[model samples]
Target: MSRWPNLKQLHYLVALAECENFNRAAKACFVSQSTLSTGIQNLEELLGVQLIERDNKSFIMTPIGLEVVQRARQLLSETKDLLEMTASRGGSLSGPLRLGCIPTIAPFLLSPLVTLCGETYPDLDLLLREDTSDNLLKLLEAGELDLLLLALPYDLGSFHSRVVGQDPFRLVLHEKLIDSYEANPARYAGLPDHSLFLLEREHCLTDHALSACQLADQAKINPFAATSLYTLVQMVSHQQGATFLPEMALRAGILERTELVAVAPQGQMPHRDIGLVWRPSSCRVEAFAGLGRLVTSCLR
Candidate 1:
């Protein structure tokens, strides 16, 4: 059986499963499409099983292929941990580190942190991928990322983390809405169930903001969705409707050069804690711990 499948073949298979396209998977694996295809074919021949079903328009994984991909991920992750453990004996942390952060946090916080990582560890080739939390966590589980920056108190099970920072939610209101809410700030909490504009679904910020204001049960989140924070800010500036903004976005001048302003919601303000998380099984625990502390410093 050709000594079973090799790590390189396993990597290609996993990449294809995740990307679902040859061109994209090849690009991610840093190989030509033909090379990735050949690797996968060799693995299939060795295993005597068809892993992928090729079609004229789409690629799909067989059921067994799905199961094998999961195991391949674990094998690759363990191998990486073993290598990192060996490297740790020499007191070196330099390597290609893949990191992922959500869209909301990426624009407001990642730029300075990227520079800091470069300056602090010149040998570390840090790769950053901005995506939704779901995608980032999926990548993390697949061992595609060494660590991730994400907001907390959601359902990230079993993954260990270091709380790096917190972002408070600001009650962003239009100039005209100020008089409506300033006289009775509590009234803003009762905003018409349908008046609040929000980011599309699966954005943790949307959920966090809604929960922070205690609106999860009743607030009528508008069907008019925003693709980015700037869109929400501009909507508010034009007096479209009111919504919440994170402290980091405010600090980044999201409302700058506009009439839009933020007021702290009355009572205990709503906030989300940001953290750097990694799989506990990772061999880079020491490096991740050091990186976590460094991340907090850069964030500030």
Candidate 2:
């Protein structure tokens, strides 16, 4: 039977893999460079394999070392979960909670929530990453994030979610376009394709906006697309284009300086569900629930 590597050694290996520099890895692990090196050497001896190749200029992990590093990350994640569970059992709310937030939601939602969390749970450690919904979900599935704050309507078949609130979409237009539209709303009915600015493809919000606005004719779609809400706002502010924004974002002062006019649709307001999502099998479900409640409270 092969002997197992100690958790300390596995931690060092993971840190080295991440940093790719012994000195930096040692600093990350809060250990002396010599101690870190000796630990890796002991780990290699115990496993009977050379895990890393080191020279003057660079450090390289062998193929086997790469595989080991992958496994080491999983082990560390499991270890963290175990420790969190233990702490929870002891009635303590302390440890690292990795969270992912979609770009559209993060700017408007997280600032106040972060302040609230800091005041409420001083012991809780939060590690935040911002990305698109698709990317965030991929990270959640890979165990890289414990929870995700996503603007919903995209399919989430295997995950559990708690809806915190709804954020309605408001029509955004350049000041000139607003005056034109107000003077004669029918002029916008046959507007040119380039007059409408939208988020780039692959974002769920783009689809939601299109569907909600009944913009099914592909020929009337905008040629210019933006990757972020901020970019879309910028395009609308500078160029003679119009777009849509979430109500919460407008309320959060997204258009404070811009000469952008926000208007609700005549009929049903277009909106998206904002929620907290987590893997159904997560042991940190309670923590996620707590976070959801806090978020709901703050939003209210």
TM-score of each: 0.85, 0.81
RMSD of each: 3.2, 3.5
Worst 10-residue lDDT window, candidate 1: 184-193
**N/CA/C clash count, model 2:** 0
Estimate the TM-score for candidate 1: 0.85
* lDDT tens digits by residue: candidate 2, 1-300: 367789999999989987888999999999999999999999989988899998887879999889988888777767766676777763344577888988788888788888887887788888899988888887776577888988877788798988888878887887777666566554456455677788987777887777675555565457889998889999888986788788777888888888888876433767788899987656777777777777876666
Q: Encode model 1's per-residue lDDT on 70-169: one tens digit a residue.
A: 9999999878767766766424558777889988899988887878878888887788999988888888887778789998866788888888777888
Model 2, CA-based lDDT: 0.80
Candidate 2 segments whose C-alpha is farther than 4 A from its true place: 90-96, 118-127, 134-144, 153-160, 178-189, 200-204, 219-221, 265-269, 279-281
Q: What is the lDDT of residue 6 in candidate 2?
A: 90
List the lowest-lDDT window of 10 residues for candidate 2. Answer: 183-192
Model 1, runs deviating above 4 Å: 16-42, 48-61, 88-93, 189-193, 216-220
Q: lDDT values of the candidates?
A: 0.81, 0.80
